[model samples]
Target: MKGDYNFFSDKKDDPLDAVCPKLSYQQRLWGFLICSGIGWFLEFCAFISFFQGNGKEFAIIFSIGNLVAIMSTLFLSGPKDQCKKMADKSRLISTIIFFSTLIVTLVLAFATDLTFLTLLMTLVQFCAYVWYVLSFIPFGQRMLKKFFSSCCEFE
Candidate 1:
């Protein structure tokens, strides 16, 4: 099994090949979900302790949990193939939804008031997160793929 002959390998066999394998979409999605769950739990615990005046412990937990969440989210969103397939309209829509969600979440996180409107916005943010996840699902992926394919057919 010479390295030159192995197209599936990640790197060359100069005794320094990294063992990172390409994950399937399901694997990446599940990994992202699990890490997110763990990260959220750690953040919740940290927030609780922080509110209880345990500043040092809160900082430690908060930093570690956020590190995990950020890293996993960056790395475990599957391959970049789907990104290349996205149409301009789909990309624009996704970007708008993402930024809008971010704005709402930020406001909800820091706002002191707990009005009915705030609660309603929180619910909308939750639904937006669900939709954000759906945008990476196969249906969205296929839509992007088809967008490109149909354009190619016309051209």
Candidate 2:
């Protein structure tokens, strides 16, 4: 060969190649707070309804919260968004919490007559699910970093 030539030669640059900036601290804080608050409120509503002798309403509201939590998580980890990154620790803990809450939810679901307990467990599970999704966000990553740093410093 008179000259070395490669097929993958590209001198042009595309704007689409640029990555989106990570979320700001404020954005993450607001996201975490809003998501957590809405989840908590939804579950609290279900808990109250259960004690009000409105089992039907309780079930409906609880299901709604559960769907919201799961769907939101799916949205966060959605394949379309290639920028989100979750720390290893965050992913591990979230997975553990998710499974643990899932087991408790299932148990409580079958226990019957323990409406209050069931609602409480469901709430916990929803919160865990929310955290799982939040972990992939920049704010969540920062929060986790700070938490681990504090823990290490205390030791």
Candidate 3:
């Protein structure tokens, strides 16, 4: 008789043993929301600090940095096997969009008076940066696990 070489089959029954469990829909949504909220809070703090005349350069750099941090967190939270691929694609695309918007917004802000359009553009930029962070960062994964473990009531 030949010996079995099915390493995966032996471990299949233990659901929790999987490297990444499939999250429920609610878990996924909640995790995304929490991560986005965190990103927004961080950006809001940066904005407030910058408003105190820390310098326009500081504000611009901090905005970019926040975007990068959020994306990094999202990339890290993905399944280990998919992390490299997802991070490379997501980070590259996000960086391009973030910087382009930043430059354009800065130009607009300087070229024109601080009117409604300027405020709108600034808000859009902040929201875009926050969105990238929440979507790409490992923040969603961490939040999901923490929430599911503590608050979920399984029947």
Tell me, by lDDT, which candidate is best.
2
Q: Model 3 TM-score?
A: 0.37
List the RMSD of every prediction in angstroms: 11.1, 10.6, 13.8
Q: Which stretches of candidate 2 lie over 4 Å from their true place?
A: 1-48, 54-64, 72-89, 141-155
Evaluated at residue 139, the lDDT of candidate 2 is: 93
Residue-level lDDT of model 2, residues 1-155, one tens digit each, is: 32432222232322322221233445544554566567667868988988888754665566566644443432322222222233265477875786577667666666577767776777787677767766767698568668879889953
**True-vs-predicted CA distance for residue 121, candidate 2, Å:** 1.5
Per-candidate local distance difference test: 0.53, 0.57, 0.52
The pairs that clash in candidate 1 are: none
**Predicted structure 2, TM vs. truth:** 0.42
Q: Model 3, 62-132: lDDT tens per residue?
A: 45555544443332233343344344765656555655666666666567554455555666676566554
> Candidates sorted by TM-score, descending order?
2, 1, 3
RMSD of 1: 11.1
lDDT (C-alpha) at residue 132 in model 3: 48
TM-score of 1: 0.41
Best by TM-score: 2
Residue clash pairs of candidate 2 = none
Q: For model 1, what is the alpha-carbon lDDT of residue 134? A: 51
Displacement of residue 125 (Cα, Å) in model 2 is: 1.8
- Enumerate residue pairs that collide in model 3: 70-133, 73-137, 73-138, 74-136, 74-137, 74-138, 75-136, 77-138
Higher-TM-score candidate of 2 and 3: 2
